[model samples]
Target: MDVLYSLLDVHIQQLNPIIQDKTFTNTLNFILTTSTDDIVSITTPILDRFCINILPTIDHNIKSLILESKSMERILLAADYPSLTKLKLFNFKDNIVSYYFTDESSFRRIFREQITDLILIYDKNNDITVQREYRNGIHEYIMKFFHNLKYLSINGPSSHLILDDSSPTTCFSSILTKLCVYVYCFQDCLTLLDGRLKQLTTFIVEIDHSEPSSIAHNMNNLPNLTTFSIEYRCNTTEFDIQVLPLLRRMSNLEELTLIIYNENRTRLVDGTYIHNQILLHLQRLYKFNFYIRTCTDLNNVTYSLSSDNIQQTFTNIGYRHVKCILYNITRMVICHAFSLPFISNHLEYLGNTFPSIVFTRVTKLLVFDILPFEHEFFIRLARFFPFLKDLSVMNLHPQLCKSDSVNYDHNQQYPVIEYPYLDSLHLEDSYIDYVEQFINETKIRLPRLKILEVDYRKLNTITKQFTRDVTRLNCAKVHRLIMEKQVVFPKTFYVYFPLLESASSYSYYFKK
Candidate 1:
């Protein structure tokens, strides 16, 4: 209903004159279709009045093609009406048309400067028989006409846009800052744009996937660019030496996104080693995201591994190397490596406290998949990172289920005992037994515990022993008890009335 109203609103002005007029007001509703032949004859005067602009089709069979006075100038005059802000042409060929209109003296004499946004969409319903020379001419004229244009979009056929080393270039120094190009045009346009579009800060390019590195290599030289997104539908192995370095050089760049498709079985030279060498040099890149196209299906790359093969293939990628390098990082997201197989080993390595003690600077750990060693390892890991605050656990392994689980060190009687300064905890899809154990352990430890979030899907083993133990505890400092599913209530509950704020699924802690 909302969509229908919005669609009708676009033609509201046209509809108003027809609806209010005494002559055609009797026709409450009408259906308009393009298949009919004599629309001009059948169309009511009211409807005709509203038909201010006819977006002529490029189809050869369409009878209502825009053919005003058989000349380009006359056609421009015919289409250039106060109500018509858009003009679309198809199967349009020849460069002479634009050259004749856009000569400095010619444009001043004829057009008198009225056009702002110009669009030329081709290759949709036409063949190569279209005039190539005319197409080039049209491009030249349009660029010159729209010097102050803010938005320009071009989508053309791959064949028509092939560029030669000597291809003509356009200058856009007249403050055309925001530009988006989703063209199938030739790659030489990149070189032509050199030092021309200086004011452009925001750019978006969706390239033809047929040829891989052509677009990427050309885009590397864009100077003073801050925000960029380039998407390819097919995959190619060419690294486009310019892309990586250009990304590193964009000191003012805040947001960047790249979507690469892998259509061909092309193997990329492992550039992680190169990235590692260059990381130290990229002083401005405080945040970085790197993704690769290993397959055609997006999901294939997303959830690439199952639990069975996770651990074995964990250490192969540059994840370990990169993680090691960026150990000091606080906020980071590495997508492809989110599965159980990849993360378990990294966690285990951090958790291990053996012959030699290695420290992890990570304070807030967010683990996705549950591993068998998480429950046991975190107990030891907390000892090392004494100032750790947030511990968020998502999918836990069934094997980590223990009866009375607590943050207990098996070697408590040993020489050294390290205690972590944990404040907030988030447990999802955790067993009831583990939850009870966690709460019991926190009774004696975590004196500064402020929030506890528990999402227990299966509460099979929330026995009386667990409830009794929880009731016996005095966690006076704990303020929030957030429950998603029902909690098996302990024998007796201490309701800290004044201190407790709210018990809800979603919680917020604002950072000043």
Candidate 2:
């Protein structure tokens, strides 16, 4: 509960009198929430006070708890909540699940008999992990554990959650009515849609890769499912085999959401393609939200297709707040279109081609551009997305026009890019010039910047071996410094980032 703690700390002096009020202190549900902020831990004192003074007082009133694995044990053991039914567990690992969820764990009764809604959110794991075998056994254990579970969701950082559990035991969830999950492949996704959950209504999934299996594909469709959504993170070319065919079977869907982006020169997922291939087949559908981006080679375009042509298609469908941009640059016809306001909290791939609207809701953004992201583009971004907390830039080129951006001598050339709410800045896949553009106090001002991911050599060189005076202000507040490789720096490095609590290097993190 980083936001809670921060609010309490910020207003503690004024709120001490109010905090002492019996009415205020008696409401302990605020203490039961997991932190939405990047800083993912609660202080020991906060935990101790919560367990000792607060939880027991309002134990019966508690109905739900959202907790990270680190503090989950202490909080769960704090009080007996007679009314508790829902749980959203984050940062879960296999070992942690085995210790607490397998066999005779203390939470066995609560999980098996009490909880009806469960959300297990794990950290990104490429390897098959979680409660013995994530690929084979985790879903089985989940279905087996929660007896009265009506809604169950399992999420991961990436689409590669990798669940290979096609066991007949998991094939049926009699009590489950809703499921939201991520799978490694389409076969695993088809396993979920294989007409096992007779009561299942809402099914949301994000799959990494798609490989059609005739046996799984030919299995019965989800006729009971009224709500359905599918998202693709990978550049998919299998709409005919993977996506559309699956949709043709789910004819009972009432609400549908699709977020798809494809780079392959397959059919461009425009209005006509979506209508004929997808929506036309789903006769029972009423509500729809979509964000479809297609990047096709210019050489492949046969007919006249312009931004106006694409815009009219969306307009015909009565999508009022839709934003569509067509960029004919770098020998690729890149079309970005999405219905607003943007629903996803973490937008996947954004670039220089952006709409001039405030995406106040989006917390995480990935900026990828073959062309350089100059100072103006950054300024436009910071100005529009005022509440952006996480930004990952993956541009490989340096700023093309620096004269309009950088102040060489004394004249302030451009307005400094500021991210007042940003906590995480990832420049690990970007050029060193971008490193300099951000770290240099003159070009950008990151007041709330805490997490920074950069190349070790680039960081060192740009910071002038950690003694650069110009970059000190921007580097001063970085709490977690992520690098390509582990390297112990001089005393100046620590001095440069005085608030840096930790430094780490992950070769795997850079592979993204």
Best by TM-score: 2
Q: Give me the runs in candidate 1 sitting further than 4 Å from their true place.
A: 1-47, 51-112, 129-131, 135-137, 158-160, 167-173, 182-189, 206-223, 233-236, 240-242, 262-292, 295-512
Span of 10 residues, lowest total lDDT, candidate 2: 26-35
TM-score of 1: 0.37
Top lDDT: which candidate number? 2
lDDT of each: 0.40, 0.73
Error of 1 at 247 (Å): 3.4
- Per-residue lDDT tens digits for candidate 1, residues 1-512, read 12222333365666533333333221112222233111112244433323332211111111122211113343333332422223333323344344544545343332324434434444333455546664332433455665445444455442233333433354334565655565343243354345556676766665553442333333444546666655544433333433445455555665565444333323322234334534444444443443333322233233333322322333453333222210111121122222211211112112122221333443555444323433455556555445556665544445444433333423232232223455666654444444544454432255456566765333223323334343233234557756674455443334431254555655432110
Off by over 4 Å in 2: 1-61, 68-71, 123-137, 158-165, 211-218, 234-236, 368-372, 394-410, 423-433, 448-461, 478-512
